[model samples]
Target: MHMDEYELEREASAPIDMLETYYRALGWEYERSGEDEIVSTFQGSWTQYELRSIWRAEDQVLQFLALPDIRVATEKRDAIYETIGLINEQLWLGHFELWSASGLVLFRHAALLEGEDGATLSLQQAETLVEAAIEECERFYPVFQFVLWADKTPQEAIAAALIETQGEA
Candidate 1:
């Protein structure tokens, strides 16, 4: 029996199946890392990031994470912390956290898609969240560079990364 994408699995497998199908439909490069996870890479102007998403069927949640291997000197961690605090405030979705052990900064977001029937994970929501994550990464990637390489203070790095939008018709 053939099933439409939306109605493929109402309550069968985990949400990863729906997410996998959606990624294929969009022609994105992704790999099914496991039965419940998919990893996809996206390139921004400054660098490329691998976005790993996992489906937690039991919890009825989908979590997305992107972390690039950026070297952060021990001395600069404080600046990065301050910058990310300011950055998180400006972000409409998702947030950044520093994995101090590995010196890797991570961006994370999640979507809850469980209801009475089964799951409501949609292609639009998946795409929108991923796009938003990437955009957020692109928007703040320069801040890291400024703080680490240029030795800019946290405030200066944030100011440099912000893009002021002017109203223009």
Candidate 2:
């Protein structure tokens, strides 16, 4: 199924409790890891999808963007392309990596490293990758639900519902 169509379907059919169950079944191991970074894995008949959360610290932004080594600076172009190439290689291998550097405000799909130093990417590019990954996972897994709890925040659940609906449209 196409990604937009899947988003619409997900938005329409996913229920809150179901999403909760999906998260819960992963167990404490997953949740513990999520504290630092969220990681989710799904296995279908033919493919496996692994979602990893990427984080960057505030001080690291300049260094990350400039493609600088911890101690010294070098030609930015060379570093950027090299980084992008490595990331592209990983994507071809079917790994979905999401980067959240400088708080949750900036989200992007790490598409490719541009130079020798790895310059991270912007959110739009990241979303493109994420959409593809989600679609692939849904093809085989099929089942989805919104997992909500009384004590938990409603925002994530709401987002999940919307995502499900968006899948169908």
Global lDDT of each model? 0.78, 0.32
Residue 150 of model 1: what lDDT? Answer: 93
Tell me the tens digit of each residue's lDDT in model 2 across 1-169: 3335345334321122222233343352222232124444545343444445433332222111111111112323233233333334434424312122311111123333343343443333334444555553343122111211222123344445446657877
Model 2 stretches astray by more than 4 angstroms:
1-29, 59-108, 111-130, 136-169
Candidate 1 per-residue C-alpha lDDT over 22-101 given as tens digits, one digit per residue, 9 for 90 to 100: 66766779899777799977777778888898888788788989876566778889998898898899888899989889
TM-scores for all candidates: the values are 0.83, 0.25
Q: Candidate 1 — worst ten consecutive residues by lDDT sum?
A: 160-169
Clashing pairs in 1: none
Cα miss at 93, model 1 (Å)?
A: 1.0
When summed lDDT is taken over every stretch of 10 residues in candidate 2, the lowest stretch is 63-72
Local distance difference test, candidate 1: 0.78
Candidate topping lDDT: 1
Task: Compute the lDDT of residue 118 as modeled in candidate 2.
Answer: 39
Task: Candidate 1: list runs displaced more than 4 Å.
Answer: 1-14, 163-169
TM-score of model 1 relative to the true fold?
0.83
